[model samples]
Target: MLPWDAPLAGRLDRHPFTSELLRGNPLGDPHERPLWVYVPPGYDDSAERYPVIYVIQGYTGQVTMWANRTAFRPSFLETADAVFAAGAPACVVVYVDAWTAYGGSQFVDSPGTGRYHSYLCDEIVPWVDAHYRTIPERESRAISGKSSGGFGAMITPMLRPDLFGALATHAGDALYELCYLPEFGKAARALRTYDHDVFRWWDDFRSRPAFTKPGDESLLVAFGVAACFSARADGTPELPFDPVSGVVEPQVWERWLAWDPVRMAPGHAATLRDLRAVWIDAGTRDEWFLDLGATAFRDEVLQSGLPPDRLHFELFDAGHAAVDYRYPLALKWLAERLAR
Candidate 1:
């Protein structure tokens, strides 16, 4: 538990990681939108340099999710500040909202989502480094998040070798399991069968969620898109995977696999080699986020011949949506390495 008596309450930036809108994420599409961020407290005052943490928010979350005006900042920082202060200066924390109002940004560089991968790695990282007092190298940077955001964090550095050196994910989706054989397809149909009434789907979805929102803002977007679920009532695609066509034209599994981190990772040997630390954690009771997949990911790193210690895996006793509980540990582990 975080020591509430710790002095971090007053230690964080009076504000938080600030928001910046990076439009047209190398998508070559004008409709490409802007994503936001929250820079930590001391970013403006220091030229001495800092490591960076690209902490992503889940599908249901926005950039403001962790540093919410309500219950989180004080909750996390009370212990974290001491950890950071006692070591190197606390690194810069970045909160990148993965998507706009849609429930699915799988963090993939889709022709659909306009190459968000390039936007985050190519445009945003460099922008942050040039504008901020950063170590300006991948080894001093980290990425972390929960659920979908967790998946994003774990895979981003592997995918973007030159960008981040370390990653810490908590309760992230085992995408290898869900994307190929999603158990919740029928649930999507069951809720949508109730039809386009404004509040009906949302009420039902919350009443008995087969799958929780990937993060903060995602649920709202998912609920809003209930009328267009391209899958049928029995877990079959309304169109089919072969043609990659569906009634509503949802992004297909094949295109998704091309970008799925789990599938794409096996080939990134050079990038995987660049990792300074590769750590992932999830709750033992988190049925939605699997410990096995993350553990397998760690093993994948080892089998690739990256140092064994480069991959750290832990299973905590908890369930999903435990950010209030899991993230401080991430900060501690992250500081232990990047703060050097």
Candidate 2:
């Protein structure tokens, strides 16, 4: 295997996308963002419309990270190219950016984060279909991501079955009690130094290089997701748990639970049943215990009446980080299943 950049058999086109919904976002994040669309080999030579797989990112991830190369493995961009080059089914892959001042928008709409979910389903999907030779149907579209991206992948299809038909989630956040609750206590302890005020820690975090502090990850996820899931009417992030006692506030916590994919499955069973394919996986030892979440989500999907053959579930031997290698695996799987 080549240790460095490999030539792609496909073409990745980068475009500047301006979002009307994000123009005056609460965080004042930029309305213009990078959008990447990758066409598989032979795209130019043929007049065929291909299925599209929309790729989103985890927390703190933006569009360009798809090109980031690690030590031995190539980036997902390269590996995904290889999937089509080797003849798994051809697909047009889209990389979306939903970055926020708090690091991620969780791909949801909120007073705190703005109308990101609508920006994606309404703006980006239509923009891709209008610009590309895509099949332009839900069965022809799939979304994939890892971690927070995975969470988005799981929920997007559920929320908008008209736009997405299949999905692949790698350690996607779910089972709030298992994946998120533990962090509340750790964040509370970290808040002790900031007078139990996450905004104070946020101020400190911005004052220095990112993630330099002890509880940066936990606190960031706590605050950022609160901004996505439980923000108040005036756009203030309300912690689902008290910062000092680490006790979950019932009303706010229920708001967070409403966004949980595991909990969301029962209500969206019709959508889940309509799905053509679902790929779910996580490391057996995911640091956030998302493997448990993955398992619970799989159970929910199965119970929702999706056939066993249409679903792919696995538990790998690794952890949360460095799982980019798995992206192409799911990509190839979804490519074979998405309507041609």
Which predicted model would earn the best lDDT? 2
What is each predicted model's overall lDDT from 0 to 1?
0.57, 0.95
lDDT of 1 by residue, 24-93 (tens): 4322223333333334445566557878888776665665445443343354444445455555346766
> What TM-score do all the candidates reach, one by one?
0.71, 0.99
- For all predictions, the C-alpha RMSD in Å is 6.9, 0.9
Q: Report clash pairs, candidate 2.
A: none
Predicted candidate 2 versus true structure: per-residue lDDT over 1-340, tens digit per residue: 5777778899999999999999999999999999999999999999999999999999999998998987888889998999999999999999999999999999999999999999999999999999999999999999999999999999999999999999999999999999899999999999999999999999999999999889999999999999999999999999999999999999999999999999999999999988999999999989999999999999999999999999999999999999998999999999999997
Q: Positional deviation of 296 in candidate 2, in angstroms?
A: 0.7
Give the per-residue Cα lDDT of candidate 1 at 216. Answer: 18
Q: Name the regions of candidate 1 deviating beyond 4 angstroms.
A: 1-47, 69-74, 77-82, 86-89, 178-180, 191-251
